[model samples]
Target: MTSASFHPTITLPASLCEQAAQHLEQAVQRAVDGAAAPWRAFRRAESSDYTLSVSVVEQAAASLLVLAAESAQSMRPSALRALISVALHLRDAADATRRPTFTTTLW
Candidate 1:
């Protein structure tokens, strides 16, 4: 329950941070313009496009982490670290979803 349990600070290059921000911005625009439906289907229980959803989530998480790193100057170090950790977790979760699973087997 203490702040001491937060993840260690992470460092990212300025160029990468800029790229991440740009990618995130483009993704947002795509969603708003109806050019992307990954997120919408992701929220539905009957969604069949798991691959697209996972890919989008992974990219978004990476972009969030980069943006969080870029905001270090304006935010508390501890809070920023927490945000980065959360983004990392989200990215990992998206990666986990990509693993192959057995849905049916002929016996």
Candidate 2:
């Protein structure tokens, strides 16, 4: 095949996108100190001292979505943002509602 006929494209694969998201979440977790820092703390995954606050994992999940917008190679930022939002929301919803379907490993 001619080189011009099959030029490499710039679409971000789902796996790479997920890796970028996981990287961003790790950043937020550090930024939030696993949500246990001073002013940026988020509630723990299992804490009874607080009155049912949002989990740091949850906040990190949300922030990761926003962070995905800046983490991927795509046609537009909106596409990234939407992908992040949808993935996080779906995952979060599934976690909250106990409806997860797909399970996998991450590196």
Candidate 3:
């Protein structure tokens, strides 16, 4: 994982985090398996800030997908293990959210 953090100002639903992690992981795996390159799957996009310095909520919600295939192509067994570790960390973090339980009141 890159030092760049995905720290969103607002709490995102666990589902969205999970989906993002899944997409990133799948793309990385495909690249490693020679199915497709990272550049083909990940694209860059630009956004504009309509607000003047009020610190818009949207600014903090940016999702960054960075895949350095140049390095991954030559990754050794240790590197692969590290990659898997990162994926598991992301998955566990996504699942850290608490599930709500509802109780019914008998009339």
Off by over 4 Å in 2: 1-54, 74-107
Clash counts for the predictions, in order:
0, 0, 0
| Cα error, candidate 3, residue 88 (Å) | 0.6
lDDT of 2 by residue, 79-105 (tens): 566556645653454356444567687
| Residue 65, model 1, lDDT | 61
| Backbone clashes in model 2, listed as residue pairs | none
By lDDT, is 1 or 2 better?
1
What lDDT would each prediction earn against the true structure?
0.50, 0.43, 0.36
Clashes of 3: 0
Q: What lDDT tens digits, residue by residue, belong to model 3 across residues 1-107?
A: 56465332224334433443444555556454431332222221111211111111111112112233334566686765554454444434334433355679767
Give the per-residue lDDT digits (tens) of candidate 1, residues 1-107.
Answer: 67766432223334333433444554455343321343342333123322234455565575566667566798788867765765676576666666788778788
Query: Poorest 10 consecutive residues of model 3 by lDDT?
Result: 45-54
TM-score of each: 0.43, 0.29, 0.29
